[model samples]
Structure formats: C-alpha cells, structure tokens
Target chain A: MKTFFLSDGDLDEFVTNLIAKSPVFAPVAKKTRFVFNQLESVEDLRLDYDTTILPPKKLFVPTKQDLVTFEHGKYEECLAPGKKILFGVHPYDIKAISMMDWIHEESNFDIYYHSNRKATTIIGSNVQNHYKKAFFGSVCKELKVMGHDMFLTKIADGYLVEVLTKKGDDLLPDGNFTDVSKEQIKNAADVNTKADENCPSKLKNTSLEIKHKIRMYYDSDVWKKKSENCFSCGSCNIVCPTCYCFDIQDEWALEPTSGKRYRRWDACLTCEFSEVSVQGGSENFREERAERFRHRIMRKTSFLNDKLGGPACVGCGRCSGTCTADIADPVSIINEIMEK
Target chain B: MSCSSNHDKNIFLPKNAIIRKASQMTAFETHFTLKMEDESEFIYEPGQIVEAGLFGYGEIPLGLSSSPTQQGSFELVVREVGKVSKALCALKAGDTMTIRGPLGKGFPVSEFVGQDVLIVAGGIGLCPTRSMIRYIMDRRDEFKDFKLLFGARSPDELLFEDDLAYWRCSSDVNYLETVDKPNDRWKGNIGVITTLFEGIDHLDPATRVIICGPPIMYKFVIAQLAKYNISEHHIFVDLERRMKCGVGKCGHCQINDKYVCMDGPVFRYSDIKDLEEAI
Candidate 1:
C-alpha cells in the first residue's frame, strides 16, 4: 500500500540486518551466472542479475524430498510449514512460481505445497538485466507477482520497496523509512519499463503460425531427424518450473508388512514414464523421440487450450537451457513448424 | 456446488460397502456383490466403474455389472490379475470393502431407445456389458429387437449363468455364445465372437451396437460392424485404462486430451477415432 526509497548505503544496511535476523536467501554470483542460496554477505545479493541458475520453485517443491514417511500400519504425512524470506527474484521466475500456486490450489488442493508456500515471504525485484533467451516480458508483460508480499524495484540512487500484503506491512514499522518522493517513483518506473522494452525480441510482434502448421507436421520427418540426438535423460523436465507429472510408489517395510506411500516427479521424455500397469504398453506414443518431442509442445499449447485457459509454458526458457541436445526450444520448433 | 458445513468435501474417501455375495466363475475371476451402508442409490450409467478396496491394502477400478435400473445392491466381476484383485478374490461373502464411485461417463442408453440394439462382449469384458443387458431386458417393451453375443476363452468361464438361462427363455431376445475352444461337453458355437455374425440378420443399418471387452476385441468387432455398412457413430464402446484417483487429477487413464475417468470410460467410436491413445 505504501512505498519508501532506501539509499544505496541504507539498502546494504537493511539487507545485512535482515540476513542476520531471519533465514534469508538471496541471489549470489555463481561463476558466470547467479543462484539463490543462503545470503552470507550483503554484497552477494545480486539485485541486477538477469536470471538465476534455477528458479525459486525448489523452495516450494524440492527436487528430491519425501512426500511422507510411515511405519507399522500407521500413516502420517508432514505438510509442514516454515518461516523464511526469499530476496532478489526476477519477474519471470516469480510469475512461474505464482502459476504453480494456482495449480496446487485448484480442484485437488495439495496440502504439502500450500503449507510451504504460506510460510515463505517473497520479496521480488524488477528485472534490471535481461537474459538473452527470455521472451516472457512479451508473452505476459513480466510484472510483479501480485501474490508476493513485498516487491522491490531498482532506481537511480537506491531501491524502492513496495509493501503489498500483511506480511510486507509487518516487516515495515511506523517510522521505518521516510516518503518515497515522486521523483524516485518516476525514475524507478522508467528503469522497469526500459528493461521490459529491451527483453522481448522483434519476433513477438509477428503472428505465430506454429499451432496450425504443427497439426499438419505431426507426421513430419523434421522431428525424427532433429530428435535423433536425444538421450531421454529427462534433465529438461527436472529443471522446468511447469512440468508437474509424477509417479506414485508404495514402500513396504523389511518385514513386508507396512510402510510409506509417496509420489515422485516423473518426466514424459523418459521411456518408462507412460507405461501402463498391464503388459505391452503404448510404445507407439513414444516410439520415436520426435513423437515425444512434439507431444510436449501439443500438451503445452493445444491440450492446455482445452483444459487450462492458457498454454502451460510460461516462456521461462528453463527447458531450452537445461536440454543437453539443444533441441528443446519450443519457440524455434514453433517457427520451423510454421514455416513448413 | 453442494458445499456445506456438515458435508465432507472429500469425494475420494470410500464408504463402507460389505461384500454380501461372492461367486467364483473362473479360476482367475470372482464376482463380488457389494451393498453400501447408507442404502442410497449409487445411480450410474451402464459403462461406469467404481473403486473398491481393502483398508490397509489398496484399491482397483471395477466395472459396474449390475444395472442402475436395479438399485440398492451393486455388483462387480473382477478378474484377479494384479495384487489388489487377487487380494479381493480371497475375500468371501460377508467381508467388508471400502468403495468410492459410480464414476466416469457411461453409455447414453436414452439415445438408443426404440432402435434395434446389438450387444457384444468378449471374455471378462462382459461385466460392463451385463449392465446394459439387464437394462435392455427390463425395458424390452421399448425396443424393436435385442441381440446378445458373448465370447470367452472357454465355456466354463461364462459369467451370470442364471441370468443367461432366463434370457434364453425370453421371446424378444436372441442370445448367442461362443468360446475359443470347444470341449467334449460343449454343444454351442466354437470360435471368436465375430464369427457368430455369419448369416445373422438381426441388426438393421439403423441399429445401435454396444460392444465391450478386452482391447484386442474392439478392432475386429468394429471391422465386422463396418462390413454391415454401419456408421462409426452407431457403434459405442467402453475403454479400460489404468485409473487411479477416479477424478481426473491423478494423470493416469488419459487418452490423448481426454481423461478416461471424467470425459469418458464410455465413448462413441466416432468421438475418439482420431485420438491416438484409443484402441
């Protein structure tokens, strides 16, 4: 509801104090890129980083975590919540996390996800630097996740912090900071708009012909030729913020009596992902690597058009970045299909 | 839409259903007649299925064999191939099982009223077809003619012997049964059920054919129906998929873009001919 401008010196002091007081995670420079980790020093908070090595989804849904543990015919699931703060998130990654929030809340609400989500206080920042591969600003106008409690934008001399939720209001006391002058607000808005304008390529202006041509190119030879290098390691799916497919497994104890039942993330790119309980599963579905390649595109664009309102892909570019074969970019596939 | 303070929102939770009757038809198959505690009607269409379970073990999808027209008690004929089914078959009459269902899209019988009906079932796939068979028998006066054809691996595996005998006595209904192999005591037709179509003129081109059974039986039966110049829309079938969560969320039992649990376990041939995952 209210905004305040903190000077560069004050910004450092504020971050240092927060890190010392709370369990805070911030973007730290990792080789050529940045990653979210425990903020040991104030300087490690890379406010100008374009993107992180991994999106902040790991905080909500960990890469490898137990769903629940059980013993002796009694089952107890832990949908535990914790208190923490995540700082310096880019708009695109923030948008991806918010989309996951909606999915976990709708219909069959996931208790495990919701609990962790409620405990975390998100402090998102406007993108000051653009990753070359990012096209999200054009697709969805990369804006602050309205769901986040506290949001920050970099201005000329300092950072402009906006308090949007009760959690944000709690962080800011009565006399925390003075007025966010009109000049500061105007300058912050200008920098944010300039960043958005520079993010998307000129290709965003053209009409996409991918969907119509993809229908015709379902049996095309291009996919087969291109997908020959795929190893089916499913690394792309593991890194993606939107790939939510999973497999359920039940584990009995060494005594063969009682144990835990849990679900783990699964990827369609893997051979065993679509296997049926019965014999002779649909090898036809994933017979060729190209079919699997094209099916992922169809699931994001068309199948989602019928089920969920929008395409499932948020244009985050995580799949393309994670793919070892350099053939997973749906945008390039879309363009090629359209041209054909 | 029916949210209330007293009403529990969990549809996945099972109600206590006691197995009132259990009969062993084949070495690998058993029929369990279950009745719920509330005594409310578990009203559902012909091809819908229910999830039955033992408390600490697990659950499996079992097709509803009894018709919705016959309420109070429902029946499921399960072939014991997996762990859950094998555990289910071990239970005798008066055993309790938890059940949640009457789920999924079932065959549209109202659309087939007053038209000639062709019913075909193969092996253990006859369970869902039995629902339609019983329904058609009850409402026999509303239809023109009824033809039933069933095929199993052998004569000893045929389900519902008493009901089959009663149908044989009915004047409006003509039933033909076949097995892959005929033993010394066998006196009926011996071959695939498709062969029983020879010289049989019971169905008009306007007749609606409802067939269910194993996945392998569908294409062959469809080819025979097409030989009679029947339109794809006139033929309906039920599908079996690995269904868990009976609601669409579990992500199993999907056929292309459709969820078999919600969009259909029953669908017209024309509706899903283009779907790659469909049989």
Candidate 2:
C-alpha cells in the first residue's frame, strides 16, 4: 500500500481525468437526500454527503436484471453488464460489498454477483460529511477496511491517496500525487479514525455478548412489542446494503415463443418471502410480524455472524432513518435486549 | 449465451428437457417423464430434488420419483398445487420445461446394508420414497427384510397402484396398504398409517426407518417409533421449505442457520431435532 499527497487543485484534476477516462458513478445531490449516480462532471462529485438513500450494493447486485433467456426449448444464461468505475463509496459500503462477495462465493458460486463484482473497480473514501456523525457504534471501529481498489482521505490542504491494489496503481495518472510528509500522513490517519469514531448510539455489550443476547431473546416478547408498530413496508430491507434475497420470474417478449427469466431484489419481511402453496391453500413459514422482525435481527446479529466473523449490520443507520414506523432502529432494539 | 454465463459455474441455470410424458395420476397430481434434450444421463439418488419448471412460469423443487438407474430421463410426480406446479401438470408430451440440480443430500442406502429397511410414505410422500424403495429392491440380497407401509386419503388417491401390486406378490418385500376411508372395492386395512405399526411392533434396534408425509404425520409417526428401542439417529425425514435459489442465498429455506437446499432436504432426525422450524 502506497500513500501520497495531492493538493486540492491537483486532486480535482485527477478526478476529472478519471471521469473522462471511464463511466464514473459517484455520490451526488438527489432532492433533499444524496445518491450515487453517474457523474456528469468532476463538480458533480459530492464528497461531503452524510449518507446515500441506497447503498452502493445496488450497483453491484442490481435491483433487477435478466439472468436467463428462453427461446422455444433452449435455455441460456445472460452475461452481466460491462465494467465501470464505482466511485466515492464510503467505508461501511466497502465492507458491505466485501461481505456480498464472501456470501455469494462462500459455498455455491453466484455467477451474476461474481461477474458483476469483477466488472467494476471500487474507489473508497472516508466520510467527509463530518458535520453530522452517522456512525454504526463501537462496532464501527471493528469494521475492517477492505475490498477497495483505491481509498481517499480528505486532509486540510489536500487529499491523502492510498493506492491499495494493482488496479489503483494502474489508474493513477502521471503527475498530481506526490510523497506525503509525516505530519500530512498523521493528519490522514486522524481523518480515517474520525470515520470509525462517529457513532450515534453505542453498543453497550461486546460483540459476542450482543450475539448471545440476540440468541437468548429469540422467544422474548421484545420482538412482538417491536413489531407491533412496524409497517412491513420493506424500507429497512430495501435500504440495507447486505440484504441479498431475490425472486426469479419469467417475462414474455414481443415474440410469443421468446422470454427471459429475470431476478429482482426480494424483501424477507413480506409474506411472499417464504410462502409455499399447498394442495389448494398456502403456507407461510413466518406468518407473524414478530417472527419476521425476529428473523431479520437474528440474521444480522447471529445467523450470518458465524460465516462473516461479525455482525452483518454495518451500523450505517439508514434503516432507522428510513423507517416510517420508527421501530426498525437496531440501536434501540439491540440495547433493549441487552438491558433485559 | 456467452462463455462468462456458461454452465460451468452458473449453478442457477437449468437444463433443457422435453416432457416425454405428462399423464394424470390423480385429480390433483400429474406424473411427468422428462428426457434431457441432449439425451445425457440424469444421475441422482432418491430423496434428492430437481428445480422443475417451464419458462413462462417460475421453478419449484420437486423430488425425483424414479430411481437414478433410469438414465437419459427422469420422473416427477407433481401435485397441481401452485402456479408453477399447475403449469407443470398442464404440460404434455413434446412440450418443453427446464430442470436444475439433482441437488441436496440424498438417502444413504449403503448405511442400510444388512439392516431391516422400513419406508413409510403417506399420500404424495411416496414420490421421494419411490426411488429409495426401488433402489433397495434392485439389490435385495444386500439388505434384510423390506417393508413398505403406504396410506392414502382414499382408494382413488392411492398412487403407484401397479408398483404396489407387484410388491405385494414379491417375497423380497412385505407390502402393506391402508386408506383413511375405504370404498366398496377396497378390502385392505382402513386406518391411519400409525395403526399399521401395531402389526409390526416386534422390531429390532438395528432397523432403519424413514418417514415422509405432511407435518402432522411426523408427530404421530415419531411417537410410535419412539416406543421401540431403535436408535434415534437411525430415523430420517425429508422436510420442505420455500426456496428460490438452490444455492442457499435466497434466505427463504433457512431454518436457523441450516440451509435446507445445502444441508438437506433429507436430514437424519437426530441431527435436525434441535432445529425448531424443521419438523
């Protein structure tokens, strides 16, 4: 890993070059909130944004895409879209993408996620929107910085660029960046440290303790109480960067004989998530709202912890912000369980 | 169509198969025989499942009803339940559909070697059990006495009537049948499946048992089996869950941490006793 310093003007020029070279998608203004969209110019890149409405995972594993096409009796898989640059991703999203990479290829390989992930280059950055802290709590410090090709840290006079991968090295232009001084390097460390320290609500218990509490409270009334106010609108599931459940279906084309099987993001909170049709009736595994609420919590705090080596929740606080019922917040739910 | 989306690592992509035969088995169920378009051997064990569906309709997991010995083709007895199964049932010969896998853990027949084999199928439970019993019968000398206890709602719903008649006359298998409500033509045992256990109570501890039926049948069958000294691990069951991706990411078929697609559609009772959602 090599760290270099780029003055503010040079950094702007470097980013402008990147936009000119490839299709750069970066965070930009979207109404009152912010979102990752294709950059029209270097000026459209908003490094000082609190959070995006949707996590960058939507770019990697799209909301909807065709998986296979069927013509007559023949079935063939559709290749993923071409390569592009995923720019200005936050640290939490970087971890989310890495987790997506792990779960997709951990056991049974998912060619869709695999090829799409390979088709893009990720440029990560520390939170520059330091005015409002949107931290994931103490676990934020524990979230590993990985799965990024290149990373940027905003310093007082310039930006400290850390080229972590070969892709990052190849993307670096000839002149803008220079060797960093000791003080400039220390300032860069503080900026990254601030990103981890920016927690809104802290996790009182240790990671293991919280996981144990989640398992112990499986039969607890807390879930029922929490789910009572829930709307099941799937806002939480939709905002989550790591919720990868999906539904597959076939859509007909203009030609009667041709159709394509497509997959779209599925929300586990909905009745359609686990409904199975019986002889003439239907059966749903999680029929209760409490059970659905409990499932999402257990999945985040305990179920995937075994495989991903930590809680799946990145503490990005998007769920809490988006919930209309205001009960989808993990901070209160997790804290309440620990107290009980 | 491209090399990147090729079948090598594309686990979700299904194989093209033509419906060789799709005949009505009952009022609600249809028997479909599929021949892979390439005419390649479809290798699999009993108790394993295939994601069978047509293009316009989505796929559903159906247990293979025929023995793996029947290569270049396979059989599935699909009960017309949902949109997918209904579409499958309506399909006729020369009509096309798709199939993925032969997936999940299948019954371990080698472990039943030299042991008394008991297969209990209630109604459509016979679908997954058909291949197992047929495989065991093909090599009867490798095992001890074979017993099949089948119970359907009525005489009309009793499936595989031809196979039942053949087993009744064979000395290798002790075949028993019952119906919840008998008709004028029926003269066999008339009761639930648990009632037949009374006749075969003289069981050995080494006997291996497999139960497949509705969720309610498991409660009674397991209770009946518990009375004997048979090892709990010796009993196995096939459980179902909602699944879209057979590769475990869809998150629908999960009970606790166990992915029914990967961990099992067939799990030894002892191993899955702790999973609350699994019955």
Candidate 3:
C-alpha cells in the first residue's frame, strides 16, 4: 500500500512523463461523452469523468482479433500481446472486467485473451461523477475495491494515488511526491463514501428479487408491447460492458490460397447470431421479439449470477443510453419486474 | 505466476484439419473425412460434435460420425443448409479446414458396454448415432446386443449406405430402417423413426437408448422407448445448439446453466428432462 499525493501541476507532469514512456490509454472527450483513446499529451486525459462509451474490456478482448494464420496446407497459431496502460477505469468497469477475466480463463482458458491481458497495466480511478443509472456499488461493493495495478482518488486540491502492483510502481515519473499522511488517507475514504451515496434512489441490491420477478414475468405480454419498436440493432450489446459474444471467420486473400482466421464481436440482437449448419437458426426457441428482450434481461440477472457469482451488468447505463428503440434501459426493466 | 507458463497451459484453441475424403451422400448433404494437421487421432466418444470452420468462411457445430477406434482421422456429415455448411460442401479433397473439438461431453460408452443398446435416429439425426454404431462394431465382443432403428425422409436422404449394410449383416445386431415417404423399390417400414421402435422386440430395463434428431422427434421416440420399461437414466440424447466457442465461453450454446458445447452435446435423459428448452 504505497500511497503518495501530487498537486494538480505535478499530476500534469506525471501524465506527460507516463505518455512519453509508454502507450497510455485514457478517456478523451467525444462529442458530449468520452471514449478510451491513446493519450498523446497530459491535456488529453480526463481524470474526472462519468463513464466512457465503451468499457475497458475492449483493450484485452478486442472487437476484431486474429486467432491464427494458415496457408499452403499448413497452419501456425499467432498469439500476440499488446503493451499498454489502461487508464481512467472506474471500479464498476474494473469489476466487470474482472468477471470477464474469470470467465475467459476458468474452464478451458483462452490463450488469446490471457496473453493480451498479461501485457497490459490497469490503472483505476474513483468515480467523481456517476452515471444517472449507475448502481454497481449496491450489487457488489465494487466501487470500494477492484483489480487494478494502481488506484487514484481525487482529493480537495490534489490526487491520492495508491500503487498496488510492481507495474504501477514503475509508472511513477521522478518519484517525487508528498508522502501520504493520516489526513490524506481519511480524505480518500470520504470520497469513496460520498460516491456510494450518489447512487440513484431506485437502485438497490434486491438482485435476487429482481431475478424472481423476471422469472414470474417470463410469459408476460408486457415485454412484447415494450419491445415492438426494436429493430434488432444490437446497440445494447455493443455498448454493454459485460457482453462477450463473438463470431469467428476466415479472411482469405484474393487468390483464395491463404488467409488469416479471426474473431469479431457479435451480438444476439442480430438476426444471424444464432444461425448454424444443422438447423438454420436455434434462436427460434425464443423467436418472438418480446422473448429476446426478456432473455437479455434474464442473462444479466439469473444466468450470469449463476455462472459468475453476481449479475454481469455493472450498472454503467451504457445499454440504456445507446438503445435506439428507447426500451433497453435495464434499470427500468428491473423496476418493472419489481412492480410485479 | 510466470506469464509464459500461464499461456503454455492455455492452448485449448481448435487445430486445422484436412479433408482427406469427401462425398455428396445426398443432394443437400456431404460427408467429409477430416484429419488433423499433426495427424493426431480425434479421440471422441459417439454423439460428439467439432467446431468445423472453412477458412475465409465461417464455423458450425458438426457431429463426429467416425468411431474413435479409427485412428488419425474422423468424419463429419455436413448438410448445406446455411452459409458455413454451404461453404464446407463446396470444398474438395486435399483442401484444408479449421476445427476445434471433441469439445462437448459425449455419450457414456463405458457405462453402456455390457448392456443392450437401442439407437433411434431421425432424418439426418442418423449422423451422430453412426459413431455409436461404428464403435459397437469395432468392439463387438464387449457389448451384449446392438439394435438400430433409423429413419429419414427418402432413400436418397439416408446417410452412410455402406455402413448401414455392414450393420444389417452383423449377427449380433438387429437393424431396421424406414423412410417417411417411400418409392416403389422401397420395401421397408413406412413411418417416422418412432414407429419403427414399436416392432422391435422387448428391451431389457437396463438397456441404454440413444436418440438424436430434431426437437419434434424426441417426444415421440422417448414415449415409445418408455413402453420398453427403460428408466430415464438408461436413456440418453444429444441436444444440438448454435455454438460459437466450443470452450463454453460463448452464451449462444446455453440451455439453462448448461452450455451444450462443454457440459453436454450429449446428456442422460434423466439429468435434463426438467430442462424445458430440451425435448
């Protein structure tokens, strides 16, 4: 628990030194929201932000990743790692990534994902600004502690940085900062307590209750009426912090003799997501629009909890914010389930 | 832990296999004999599927039809029903394809060795059960009796004609086949796969029954098998789902907490009878 404090000026100096040395990825301004991007300068980083359009999971399990390359009746697996610094990760997002890590490495273990994850350094920051629907603290107390090489908390006039790993210790430039005092430690704890108090009034850890309500309403007609406007656009999946479904494909060169096999992010919201060779599609089991809608919610509530200890939703509010049909808000759906 | 050892222990990815032999058994279907790059044998029990992929194309779950006793290569009977299989059917001999499997939990062959085995296959469902048929033949001395009740839509739709002929001639096996619609030359039973089970002799209560087919076939076949007094534990079925990652990471293959790719593509009927999604 190596703790240090840096003034706003010193923070800029540290950011500049870190960017010059390694590839640092942090949130940058996009239109009205923010997105994780490679930091080129101190000014490019946003230390105080609500949430990014995409979670930091993309840094490890990318949208499109090459699995192997084959040619001329021979095949060689290509597994590469990217050296990076994942910056500005909120605790909820970190919690989501940790769950994903467990899933990818649990049974069979994914070499591609595990290798990429090893080469990256994770830097987490306290949530100074919470999304309107954010409620992860109640679900898992994720805001208090998470898996990160480094954690940063905003204080009155400076930032309290806690280095949790050797990789985090290596990121310090000049290594000159005010030593942590008792008062500074108390300030860090107060900031975290305030963040937990900021959750929306409707949000609660009644997750098991939500699961029961969802099961009771599995056959309800309200889902059909609510999901009628969906175009199966898959925006909810694309923006979700925990959705990890992918589609693998081969890309042959123009000559058709050789190519690389790769996998890209896929979504159940898409019509062809369930297409297979034996039967064209198995999603027919849940063919109705309403059924698909309920299934996604069921995944976040019951299925993921059964598999990974708790719900997969980090309560980041990205799904609700990105849905075009205006019916993808998970909190609203949970609220409706609770009403029953 | 060291990063290298962590990665070395995580090589569960599918390997590329070559199509050593291929044939169009039906107008819409083709059977491919696949061999791994390293030439290692694909040792899998009957009623398992591999994630077969055509490079530059896509992937789909195809049942393993060849017996594991046959070393160095395995067989998959592919139907050109979708984009991936359509591409697979277009490939010829000597062409290379990618695959990852022996993935799902296959049939409990060890548990059924000395008992009577009743196999019911419907339409193309005969593809998976073919593995069990070949296994029983390879180790004929170990089993008590072999009975095959298979059905398809037409004579042309029946899979592995040569193999069926071999099973029909074996003394230890009682083989019967039917087609839903018959031609003038056809002289066998004329009904669904379930109807053929009615004419078969009494099966022991310890007899193990294996079924593979569309969801609609299970309800009828299991009901008919139930009359033979076989307990649910003695009954097994292979349930196929759309699987992308055969390692169980992908949610597409899920039926409740069970991922058809890992937990099972094969299951004891007693274990999954309560699973509403399974027939």
- Whose DockQ is greatest here? 2
**Residue A217 error for model 3, in Å?**
4.3
Q: In angstroms, give how far residue B58 of model 2 lies from its true place.
A: 2.0
Please give the clash total of every predicted structure, in order.
0, 0, 1
Worst 10 residues of 3 chain B by lDDT: B1-10
Regions more than 4 Å wrong, model 2: A130-135, A140-143, B1-7
* Per-residue lDDT of model 1, residues B163-184, tens digit only: 8788768786888889998888
Native interface contact recovery, model 1:
0.05
Q: Could you give candidate 2's per-residue lDDT for residues B94-124 as a string of tens digits?
A: 9878889888888987888889988888998
Per-residue lDDT of A229-250 in model 2, one digit per residue for the tens? 8777778998998898888888
Best candidate according to lDDT: 2
lDDT of all predictions: 0.73, 0.83, 0.79
lDDT per residue as tens, model 3, B1-279: 112234365343567788999999989889999888777777787878888887667678878988888888899988888777888899899987777777788889998899888888887888888888888888988988889888888887878888878777978689988899999988888988877867876889899889988878898988887887889998999887787778787677777567888888899999988765667
Model 2 TM-score (2 dp)? 0.95
- Which one wins on TM-score? 2
True contacts kept of each: 0.05, 0.62, 0.48
